[model samples]
Target: MRLLLVTLVCLVGLAPALASDLLIVTEEFPPYNYQEDGKAKGMSVEVVEAVLDEIGEEAEFVFYPWARSYLTAQNRKNTLIFSIGRIPEREDLFDWVGVIAPFNTSFYKLASNGAIEIGTLDDAKHYSVGVSVKDVIYQYLKGQNFTNLKVVGEDILNIRKLAHGRLDLIAFDEASFAHRVAQEELEPLLFRQVYRLEDLSGDLYMAFNKDSDPDLVERFRSGLRTIKENGRYDEILMRYQLMN
Candidate 1:
């Protein structure tokens, strides 16, 4: 009886460590994941939290700069990155689940500038364009030998540069750029989305480390599907004014 009791105690001690924990990485991209009122609140955060809740797991979110966050997700164990675009080069780097949102890459110009008519990527070849550094859209443009492109460290800077005439055009995710414009009161700058790159339509997903247990990834995926079906996911998105 004492031997059995000792064995039971050993099992109990091991149970908590055996339970899965999710490590999440995010950046300060508003309407997705950002801090407000001393809390991590956004459409992606709420949606990810709901999924974890449904799966009987908890998450620990580590906020970092965009580049650092991407690298952390790439190198760390049990870590997942949110709102990452599904790109061809990054397709196999991690286990993917939950295409949390879809956004379009667009070319924006000042409202008063009607002279610059950008109907396609090739049309803007002559003018200087700004995009976020290490962004998928920027990489795509670079690969096409688009010579007049500049990289900004952050998305907000790209918008500001365009507003200030430092750049002729800016390429960014539509939702993110719109949110920044609204928040920064840049409406007078005349933002026009000239071309929506269909190939660059970003499918945002929760990507876990490749070495992560497949069962855990599937659990999260199942939970995400459930939330989508039950309308919880949509409601969360609506709360953030993200869903159209």
Candidate 2:
């Protein structure tokens, strides 16, 4: 009984520390989240940092593959994943923080591939679609009942496959697709946006594990509101415009 009492006392004393500490996870999504010269640096990183600062909280960030990050955020206590789309399948899985960045997903085909055309979401069904494995786009397509999808580990691989004529259509977020194309010095005009997934067009958010303290999430939200009101949010966005 004495040992039990001591344990409870220790835990009570450690509660605030555990509540304020967080393990933030993110993927290498350029302009939003990525590594620069061996350091975690990006627009989302800056925004998250600013909000944590305002809320008097501290977090350590680690970059992981999206699938791993997503899984971790789903299962680990106090784990947060940033720049994730809040899809319906994930609606109640995590405590969502508001818009960290904008996301516009679309189906793209090689401009040279005049044979392929997608006028609507239904029209895309007949053709082969390339998607990143375990990505929100993949989930979205699966939800839409798309069967002819070639899932790759990296979205960049889909770009390569699309260019090589391995896919009839590829799904990608507009900003990320453009960034990757530019990174590879590929001609952007080579790809044409055949159709935009209107339903998938929404702002990305920072999401915490479902088991996280609700008060902590609210505090972060408050901090975010403060930053937006103070113009720091817009400032961060503008500072990263060059990357976008």
C-alpha lDDT values of all predictions: 0.75, 0.80
Worst 10 residues of 1 by lDDT: 1-10
Once fitted onto the true fold, the runs of candidate 2 whose alpha carbons sit more than 4 angstroms away are 1-21, 241-244
Q: Largest lDDT belongs to which candidate?
A: 2
Native-referenced Cα lDDT, model 1:
0.75
Q: For each candidate, what TM-score against the reference?
A: 0.85, 0.88
How well is each residue in 1-244 modelled by candidate 1, as lDDT tens digits? Answer: 0100001112111112223455777777887877675567678877888887788776556666576677767776677788788877788888888688767788888877878997677898878989877767787788778999898777889888888888889888888887888989867447788778777885778888888778888898999999999999988877766664
lDDT by residue (175-218, candidate 2, tens digit) is 88888899878999989999999888878899889998888888
